[model samples]
Target: MNRISIIIPMLNEADHIDNLLTHLLENSSKENIADIIIVDGGSTDGSLDIVSKYKSISFFSSPKGRAKQMNLGAKYATGNILYFLHADSFPPKNFDTLIITEVKKGHEAGCFIMKFNSNHWWLKLAGQLTRLSWQACRGGDQSQFITTSLFNNIGRFNEDFTIYEDNDLIARLYDRKQFVVIQKWLTTSARCYYTNGVWKLQYYYWRIHLKKWMGADAKELNRYYKKYVC
Candidate 1:
């Protein structure tokens, strides 16, 4: 049986981690999940305490950065497949089975299409676009799953990235034609878009993509994200 290890990297996400984990547990079969690893980046919001209370979760601390935290979690994962999920995102029911089925079909890595909790026109359009295999539509919030062997072969996510680490890994997977966009949809929080004005945030996001395409390094992209998006 192919079991999956779910790894979530979080920081100050007390608002959603508990509920998300509970949802995952409720939706997934215990037999399909080998482990749930919650990698905290020095959260001050009692997130670690909540994670510790969970029966089957393994919690650990890492330096504050999603890339570093996820990489650390992967190091300790024991399952044949690693599923990197966001604290605020929820995958569809039977997601583990879906992923295992894909792996069985020979896909080495992939992510589900993304949907935002909100029903705004633009958000809906964005969600619809994720159905395409185009790389521009992919994001960390969509949630990623990869065979452990392929993950090791790709050297995992680059810890140097403060952001866009998912895209970086996706790019390599695309380069090798080892990635797919599953037909299922994952609903992710639109909190960031809500916090920052929708149009304003969207524009800046496009700008960041442009900058990255223009050869901006991780630090440069991080700087832009902190200044405009965060």
Candidate 2:
């Protein structure tokens, strides 16, 4: 049996963490779960208190960056596979079995197809695109699963990336042809879209992609995100 470590990087995610934990615990088998590691990026919103209430979770504080926090969680993970999940994304039932089956078949890394929790046409369209194997559709919100050996080989998430870290890692996996899109759909929060306005958030996301394509470094991407999204 392959052990699985679910690593969640959080910052002021108190509202969603408990629900996410409950869902995960209910859906996953205790025998397959190596540990649940929550690496908080200095959350002051009672996130720590909620995490403390869950005996199955192991928590740590890292600098305020998702890439940094996730890498920190990976460093302490003892599982054969490391599952990087966002607090607001919920994977399908039997996700553990699905991942282990794929690994047993020799797949090194993969992510679930995802649906944003929105009924808007564009969001639905965007969710549909994730079902395809295109690298452009990949994102951390979909939740990534990779063998620990493969993760170590890739050097883990790039700490320099304050944004686009998921794309960066996916890009590398694509280059090696080690990526797969599992058929199951993971549901992710569309709170950003609702909070930032649907079209406005979509436009900025495309702009950031274009900036990265035009050789914008991590700092440049971070600046764009802070100005537009944060």
Candidate 3:
């Protein structure tokens, strides 16, 4: 009977927030959801107004960084499990039941494999690879869920990271062998890739992952992302 708190960190995401929230409400039972919390990073795109109108959801403000916003939402969550999701990603139907089922089975941390909303062959292949439990295939777009106790134990997402925070947290989970990959798929927006060009965007993304693995500092990593991806 553990409830889930869906925490989303967003900035200028008005274009996607309403539909995403509606999908979540329609697909999951209110009884299984303690609350949906939207932690805004000073959004100026009317995203705040949209979230505020949602029933049974809480709204909070935070400094403009993904990690900081998510951590802030975690602090205010009341559910036993915290589900961190992207504003542009949509989980499968009955995802709440799936998460509760896995948690009851003792899988404390995990995420659904994700497919980009693109028909491109490379994107399809990338999505397929996420079905494997290998660490290399994981990313924030897939969305993450972890027991509140375990999240507290691990000290939560590193605020030092302006980006790549999800991978950083997943690396720790992997180190402790405390992660799993649910077979279901979350559909994430491919807007970034489309806007930046699929091949070019992916190259920079892969490079960032490599740099992080090679011990690049958070500042250095963010610099590269801003220069290349943003």
Candidate 4:
């Protein structure tokens, strides 16, 4: 029987951790989940305390980088399927069944289409665009599900990336034509866009995509992100 190990690499996500966990339990079958792993990267906002409330969750600490954190989680996971999710993204109801169905059908890697929790027009448009099967529409906020063997074979996520780690791995999957976009919607928080201004954040995101496409290294991308992610 296939099982899923859900890995959530988070930093200072106190507001969403509890709710996300509860939602996961309410929506997924206990038998389908091998375990829920919470890899914290030095969160100071009592996220650890929130996580500790759930004795069933496998919680641990890691250095402050998502790639490093997720890779570590993958190492400890016993499940045949690895589901990497963001701190504030909530997958659709019975998401586990959906993933297992896809895997049985031979989709070794994929993510559900995503939408921001916000109702801003541009955000709405962006959500609509995600319905397409284009690689550009794919992102970490949608969450990722891959078979453990395939994930290991692909070298997992690149630890060198302080950011764009998700995109980097996703691009390779697309190249191999091994990526799928499930029709369900995964809702993600747009708090960053709210705080940073949607247009500004979106512009910088596009610029980073352009830079990455131009062959900029991870270091350059991180520097550029830090310079404007305010």
Ranking by TM-score: 4, 3, 2, 1
Please state the error at residue 159 of candidate 4 in Å: 1.0
For residue 113, what is the lDDT in candidate 1?
A: 92
Q: What local distance difference test score does each model get?
A: 0.93, 0.93, 0.95, 0.95
| lDDT (Cα, tens digit) per residue for candidate 3, span 38-93 | 99888998898888897678999899999999999999999999999999999999
Error of 4 at 57 (Å): 0.1
Q: Candidate 2: lDDT of 111? A: 94
lDDT of 4 by residue, 95-160 (tens): 999999999999999999989999999999999888999999989999999999999998899988
* Candidate 1: residue pairs that collide: none
Residue 163, candidate 2: Cα error in Å is 0.7
Distance from true location, Cα of 17 in model 3, Å: 0.4
Distance from true position, residue 43, model 3, in Å? Answer: 1.0
* lDDT rank order: 4, 3, 2, 1
Q: Point to the candidate with the largest TM-score.
A: 4
Q: What lDDT score is found at residue 145 in candidate 1?
A: 98
**Each prediction's RMSD to truth:** 0.9, 0.8, 0.8, 0.7
lDDT of 4: 0.95
| Residues 1-230, model 2: lDDT tens digits | 69899999999999999999999999989888999999999999999999999987999989999999999999999999999999999999989999999999999899999999889999999999999998878888999999999999998999999989999998899999998889998999999999999999999999998998899999999999999899
User: Pick by lDDT: which candidate is best?
Assistant: 4
Cα error, residue 176 of model 1, in Å, equals: 0.5
